[model samples]
Target: MEMTTEILMSTMNTTGNGTIDGGNDVVTLLSQVSNILILVFLMISMGCTIELEDLKETFRHSAGFFVGMLCQFVLMPLIAFCLSLTFKLEGAGALSVLILACCPGGTLSNLFTYWTEGDVCLSVCMTSVSTAVAIGMMPLNLFIYSRVWTDDKAVIPYVNIATTLVSILIPVAFGVFLRWWKKEWTKYVTRFGVVLAFILIIVVWVLFFMLNPTWLFAGWQLWICAVLLPFLGYGFGYSLAILFRQPHFKCRAISFETGSQNVSLASTLIVVSFADSPLFLDMLFYPGLYAVFLYIDSFIVIMLMKGVMHLKKRRNSANDEDHDENKNDKIGLDNEGMATDQEDGVKVVAMKQIVADNSVKTDEEIKV
Candidate 1:
């Protein structure tokens, strides 16, 4: 939603009745600029992780991406629909949840994939393919899921979708080119991009809650649903990948891709779809919750991955140290055995010499 300059941006200055305050044009512009900057930087950071080889490696086994699409377009929308029904939610709440559920995997998933050491190329591809697919799937899922509660057939936010695709693909392309051209700079760009992406995600999170101040009081049901959808997506995607026996790294990538939705896209769709409704503001609530919770869970998952990696590293280091020490001890023992053998050889030589001298003395006595 931070990237949606048309509608989601309006939420930054939204009054109590869903109208964006016209007076804060400067703040809005700055927010818009920062959002774009964030998008470009993060996309580039993601691009550095991609290479022709990774792409070939990714597409070589198309199962992971295919499974990702199934999770994004199929499982997620169903989860949202089920959540809405399970919560007995109606009005904007149900619509927003379902709309969010239908969104493509967000770029942040790619970021998370990078952090988790998952298949970055696979992640980037999934984000691109899903966003493109959402042009059709968003409305289709909205039509299928929202039919129960609302009469509005969501018009695909063509501008938002187009802008999102261009914004994503171009920067990523540039990053990919930059990577190939100045290979040395890829690491620097990647590091900067990762840090920039992390900070911007936090910024967006704070901005959403700040803009929608009442969202904190929006109740636990909406909050729980926000937490549930992504995790369920994660679990379902991961399980599906394991069932298909995807590589471990690819599983993490697929899991992150499935769980993370383009809530920004969802917000854009909500604005286009519900802009005229009386409950427009209410409908906007769920996406914000989903965004924040999705990120919170992302932080948790990444930290856990880091922790596990750290433990493994330490274990390997200790094992290496122990092996080195054992090797040194063996070397010392071998050296001591060699020294002892040399000493024994010298003693035997002396004994033979003495015996020869004795024989010489006996022969001299016999001659006398």
Candidate 2:
């Protein structure tokens, strides 16, 4: 960890800037195309999971929905900004946290929410809603937070990103249309999207690491920020849900939605916006780490929640058994007490009879 920063800088500096070239670079164009396609499919996939009725119900009881939105739009961006300041990050390192934090929740969160026994409807809606609003939210956040926090004056291309976000929403709208018109096809689309997403993640991971090996030695600041961003998001999100008095299942959904970000989107943004930057690989490092670490965190969290609930149920059953035993013991003692009272009554009767018999004998002697 101590040498990570030194290694990253020295390694990248020695190897020149990066292979991404500029905006017109062939690799950059290919990357942008790929990202757009994947994002469209994923967005469509996400939209299919949401029912029109669920969305309507979600809006009707919008407390959880609003709380989730607050966590994603408000808490997450602030967390990223604070981390940037705390770690004293600059340039790509600073953008690493900011970009990941700004991107919408990932599709994987729905699956995690399901596994965690959360409100699947709420989870799917929150993810979809966040993405739907990302066009406005992402740019607004980056605009507000990026300037003050990042010491390096790396160019943040706002217009291009806004355009990109608008373009991405088309497929999601189409997917919703499908859900409304041909409900049966939505399931098949969803399954295909899931498979495609996993394939994309694996392919990107392999290709990215292969292209830039030394990012494995990225600075501790990047790693720490990556870990902290999602963890804090989950904690604060769940806390807010509790504060708002949401149910347990709803809280888990909100927490996962809050914590899980779209790494694919963030990486795409980095590739599209910062391809010209000298620190492209460095910018890529944090999102990759976040993807791995947070998923591990999710599994650990899911198992812990399941285990904790199981233990609670067992303890409750044990207490109930003890309560039954105590009731039975009380009934047995009451029966014993009744038997003792009956014996005492018999003794009293016997004494009375003896007294009566003695009195009769005295009367007979007096008469004689």
Candidate 3:
């Protein structure tokens, strides 16, 4: 719902004039264009992080890749749906949570994976695959699940989602070309993309909430879901990966992938589908809340992972030091044993010389 804010304003129009505002159309068009551009820029940056070798390696050990998809597409949506039921969320609340779950991993997941020193290649690849698959999977999930919560006959904005995904790939393909052809510039381009992506997110949110402060006033159940869902995702994702025996880096990447949803896309869908409906106001704000909580929770995971990695490093260093000390002690004991043997042999030789000299003296005296 790139144009959600404009839709929101128009929907909330209290003028009761029954006429559409001209200014809103301009705002909607601008927002839509800017959002698409931001996504393209971010996706391009994510694409640059992909390496030819990593792609080959991903195929070599494809278990982790499949696990990532399962966690993102299967487990996450299930978590969201279950949470909605458990919390007894009805109407727009249930729909909002479902939308978040159905969408693919966010572009920011790759960014967070990099920050956490995770498997960036796997993160990016999983995100790209999930997004491509979401063209079908997203609508399917909504179709199946939306019936559970309401009889509103939800509309899936498949065209908008498809257009967004296709546009995303165009920039990504270009970025990949840059990576392969102009390898020298890949580092700079990727860095620039990351920075720009962050700035865009901040700018978008600040502008959004600034204009609409009421979004921050959601119900406690929504807040609870927002906080609970991401944490559950991180925990389950990490545990599942460990059960599958994925390495630590891959686990972290998957955890972030599972937990950090593409909230921007979710918001876009809500805006596109429900903008003019009576339920628009109720559903529109939760995605922003989800974004806020996802970042906060994902950051906690990142810090915890970094701490564990540090402790592991320290323990390994301590073990190496202890091993070196034991080796040195063994070498010293061997040297001492060799030196004692040499000393004993020297004493035995001296005693033999003394005995020979004494016998020679006695024989000379007897002859005289």
Candidate 4:
């Protein structure tokens, strides 16, 4: 479970205060290495579950997907930038927020969408596409934002995009290929992938909490921002869907896709880019807040959708029962009419026979 900022910060302060000195270069290096390994594993697991059919379906709804992506990649970053200016967040906090906004939707969005009766295919599509784009866009966005916000020139660390291609893209392609080749294996892989991703997320979050305790206590504002940002993303995405005259389900799906940031990728980027900066530790808070927010929001949305679906099913069941009762009544009336007709037919036959016998007896008497 992703710990709420309050709990994490408090726990960090109380427990992990002197365990590992933050000033130690070796510890920071270890943290970065741990984050990278976990990220690679998580990405690979996530990739294995992605089906080509799902991606194809996502593209089939290209207009909506594109629009939602634009909002996530473009509009969201702009909004975060504006918020940074308004709030005057400097150093790690400002960069963290900007990076968080720039990050694409998480792979977990598919699960949430499925839970909420949204389009899972679309969510998966958006996540994969956005993540691929993020390989380039993440560094570029950070550089651009840093230049505008800070007087000191910041260097965005060089990431091996090719390594991402190998680790993330290749694995995902292989997963999709496997789906095409052996569907049964794909099912098992998807199940395993889900479990693996969850475990990795838990481990990363725990390590982060262990490293930074202060972010847990006075981090109420970060928590608030995290919780609110996702809701805003969802609301804006939903509204856009409505504007596009999309169906209710598609609207909901797009909302989820827009709301859920790929925090795993964001965390990895932070570990890679800002491993040395004390100010950059705020990057840890960005994904930590997101992980917490996404968990809560996904649960709430899923429950609400389930409630609505349950009510709809109940109403439908009642209507079906009424329809069945009406059918039974009609069948009963028809059976009663059939029974009456059979009795009337029998009586008519007996009466005709009696009249014939009487006529024959009268003719015999006249002959006698």
Q: Give the top-scoring candidate (lDDT).
A: 1
Clashes of each: 1, 0, 2, 1
Residues 270-362 of candidate 3: C-alpha lDDT, one tens digit per residue: 777786767778997677678677768877887988898899999999999999999999999999998999999999999999999999999
For each candidate, what TM-score against the reference? 0.83, 0.65, 0.82, 0.69
Each candidate: RMSD to true structure? 3.5, 8.6, 3.9, 6.0
Which regions of candidate 2 are displaced past 4 Å? 1-55, 149-212, 279-281, 319-368
Better of 3 and 4 by TM-score: 3
Tens-digit per-residue lDDT, 1-368, candidate 2: 00011123233334345433242243333433455555667667766776778778877998998899889988998998889889999777888788889877776677667567687778877876787777778878888888874433334435544544555456656777899999999999978976776566555444444434555687888888877777788889989999999998899999999999877567667766676667676786786677667766777778887897789889999999999999999999999999999999999999999999999999999999
Candidate 1 on 1-368: residue-level lDDT in tens? 24334456566466789666765555556556667778899899888878877778777889988889998899989988889889888677888888888888888888888888888889889988888988888888888778798787787888777888888899989988888888899999999987876676667555554455666767677988988987898888888989988987899899999999887778778887778888787887787677778877888878887798789889999999999999999999999999999999999999999999999999999999
- Residue pairs of candidate 2 with colliding backbone atoms: none
lDDT of 1 at 36: 79
Measured by TM-score, how close is model 1 to the native structure? 0.83
Q: Would you list the C-alpha lDDT of every candidate in the order shown?
A: 0.81, 0.72, 0.77, 0.65
- Ranked candidates (TM-score, high to low): 1, 3, 4, 2
- Single out the weakest 10-residue window by summed lDDT for candidate 1: 1-10
Please give the ranking of all candidate structures by lDDT, highest first, separated by commas. Answer: 1, 3, 2, 4
